[model samples]
Target: MQKVFFISDHHFGHKNIIDFESRPFKEVDEMTTEMIAKWNSVVGENDKVFHLGDFSFLNKEKTKAIVDKLNGYKILILGNHDRGRSRSWWLDVGFNEVSEYPIIYNNFFFLSHEPMYMNKHMPFVNVHGHIHGQKYEGKNYFNVCVEHWDYTPLTFEQIRDSVVVSEEQ
Candidate 1:
């Protein structure tokens, strides 16, 4: 059986991540290379990988290049960076789907770029990214939380372990 994984907010071409965030790479090209390599290491041709949003800093070409080189079929949930482009642009690039927010995966809520605000109506876990693990304090919300961005696919058990909850859950 193939495994499904979720990740978000790589911001590949964003200088802020390279300068402020102090990412290991000095440029987006280097970053993309490492990210693609890392993702391909864990994900296989049969696996499914979900990328939330803000994948790159307007460098769709480079981003597409990196994605095309990776293993697994990549699905994209469009983020703020995807603005100003046609809806079909993502599919034309390589993404299977381009959604706005709150996509569903195995009854779980999946979001990228930013953490989707949750209410009582949803009992599903929200696996999200877009931060250095600073924005959110808990391991999970709704049900589970994924808060890292190294282009790696995580196991369900890893996500479940990071979940945090309130009394309502």
Candidate 2:
């Protein structure tokens, strides 16, 4: 069986976001290249990747070209950018999206995306990346930053063991 990973919000080619966040890439090509390289470094060809949406910048062809070079099965969770990207004729080359996934682990069901309005009350931990380091001042939740295209997914075990628990009022 192949390994699985998850990532989200890699808004490539958006110079405005890059400038504001001080992204290392000077251009889209550079960002895409780096992201692919980083992903390959940690993930394998048969690995599974769950992208939580906002895949790229510009047209779908531009984004698809970059993702096609990667070695893995990518599943998108469909963020706002995907609305425009779906129209891109070549967007399908890299990813597929699904509504919800119910995976059992840690004696609970791990759900993804779709803003966990009541996640705090749920028995399982909601693994997501829509929010950066914002929200939930202190919690064991993981916020994968869209620093570069180089993003990796954290597993349930990793979250259960490594995430720092925060006090919620």
Candidate 3:
């Protein structure tokens, strides 16, 4: 069966990101290659991937090349860095769809590139990516930055289960 996955903050081709985020790889090529391999390992061609943002730091040509080799139907929610490009540009780069703002998915999940404010009174969980290694405190917020997930895409089920576990603790 096909699944839905979430991930962000790839920063592909950004050499400084290694030092900025303290990423394990020593080179951009190695980082991109490993991340692509990890992404394809869990995502299938028919699966849907919601990439919260900061997808790449490469030129349009290089970015498109990388996106073309990835698995799944990709959807991007513009991150801070991604705002420099247009929705059409992202589509041209191989994303099936691109959004300039947060979207509500499955009725109760609010998806965005940056964490959204949520109180106990709110009914939605914020599924976002940004802040790199840091995350907001609360089960209502879920960060899918590649750094937190071994550079692999995370299935929605995985995120749901984590929230459930957190609530129980």
Candidate 4:
């Protein structure tokens, strides 16, 4: 069966990301290669992936090249850096869908590129990215940034299990 996954802040082709995130790679190429390997390892071609944003910082050709190599039916929730690019550009680069705002998935999971603050009384869990290595204090918010997730895509089951475990604590 096909699987669903979440990931963000890839920052592909961005050399500064290595220093910014303290990523283990020594160079952009190393980071890109490793991230691609990690992603393909966990994500099959038939799977669906929600890329929360900041997907890349490369030119159109280079960005499309990277996207084409990844495994998954990719959906992009546009992040801050994704601005200035047209929705059609993202789609042409291999995203199955491009969204500019938070979207509710499965009726309970709220997906966005940045964390949306909702009160404890809110009904949905905020699944977001953009904070990189930082922690989100909200009980119902889950960060899916590549920095936090070891450059791998997270499955819906994994996120749900984490929430369940947190609730039981």
Candidate 5:
């Protein structure tokens, strides 16, 4: 069966990201290569990936090249750093879809590029990125940023399971 995955804050070709996020890699090339490998390891060509933005700081061609090298059908939720580009530009670079706002998935999960304020009364779990390494305490909020998730794409099932476990507790 095909799977759906979520990840964010790749910031490919952004050397400053290493210092900004305290990422382990020494350079942009190394970071990008490792992230690509990790993504391909779990994401098959047929899988669907929801990338919650800050995808790259490279030129259009370089960004397209990175996108082409990755596996899965990709969708993008634009983040703060993802501005200054048109939706058509993102689509042309390989994103199956691009959105400027939050999306509701499966009628229960809210997908956003940045973590939105949500509570149990909201009726939908918020799955978001940004805020990098900070911990979010709510049972209905899930962070999928690369820094928080070891730079690997997380399956919807994984996020759901965590929600289940949190609720049970």
Candidate 6:
């Protein structure tokens, strides 16, 4: 069956990311290789992956190359750094869809690159990524940054089971 996955803050080809996130890699190349492997391990060709941004620091050609190797029908939610390219550019690079802003999924999960404000009174759970090692202090926020997930994409079931939906809280 085709599954839905979520991940973000890949920072592919960003040399500083190794040290910034304390990633267990000697260099960007190693990081890229291993991350791609991990991503492919859990995601199938038919799976859908929602990447929440800060995808890469490499040039267009290089970025596209990496994206091409990833599994899944990719969709990107533009993070802060992803603003360097246009939505069409991201599409040309391999993403099936690119969103400039947050997207609502299943009428309850709010997906974004950066965490949005959510409270007990709200009707949505914010699933986001941007802060590498830090996360919001609430059940309504779910962080999918690679740092927190062993550099692997998370399935929709995993996310739903971990978060308390607004109505349930």
Predictions ranked by lDDT, top down? 3, 6, 4, 5, 1, 2
Cα-based RMSD of the predictions, in order? 3.6, 4.0, 0.7, 0.7, 0.8, 1.8
Error of 3 at 55 (Å): 0.4
Clashes of 5: 0
The TM-score of candidate 3 is 0.98
Whose lDDT is higher: candidate 2's or candidate 6's? 6
**Per-residue alpha-carbon lDDT of model 6 for 60-160, expressed as tens digits?**
89999999999999999999999988999999988999999999998989999999989778988899999989989877899999999999999999999
Model number with the top lDDT: 3
Residue-by-residue lDDT tens digits, candidate 2, 91-162: 365565443343333465344443354455565555555554344432434454555233555443445554
Candidate 6 Cα deviation (angstroms), residue 27: 0.5
lDDT of 6: 0.93
Name the runs in model 5 displaced over 4 angstroms: none
**Against the correct fold, how does model 6 do in TM-score?**
0.96
Task: Summarize candidate 5's per-residue lDDT along 1-169 as a digit string, tens digits.
Answer: 9999999999999898899899999888999999999999999999999999899888889999999999999999999988889899999888989999999999999999888889768988999988888868888789899998889999999999999999999
State the displacement of the C-alpha of residue 31, model 2, in Å, after optimal TM-score superposition: 1.6
lDDT by residue (1-169, candidate 1, tens digit) is: 8877666667766766777666778786787777778778888898887776767665568667766787887877776766656658777777776776567666765555566666557676666665544555443452211224455667554565455324336
The C-alpha lDDT values of all candidates are: 0.64, 0.58, 0.94, 0.93, 0.92, 0.93
TM-score of each: 0.79, 0.74, 0.98, 0.98, 0.97, 0.96
What is the per-residue lDDT of model 3 for residues 1-169, given as tens digits with 9 covering 90 to 100?
9899999999999899999999999799999999999999999999999999999989899999999999999999999999998999999999999999898988878999999889978988999999889989988999999999999999999988998899899
- CA lDDT, candidate 1, residue 57: 69
Clashing pairs in 1: 125-143, 125-144, 139-162, 139-163, 140-163, 140-164
- Work out candidate 1's RMSD over C-alphas: 3.6
Error of 2 at 36 (Å): 1.2
- Scanning candidate 1 in windows of ten residues, the lowest lDDT window is 138-147
**After superposition, which runs of candidate 4 have C-alpha atoms over 4 Å from their true positions?**
none
1 against 3, candidate with superior TM-score:
3
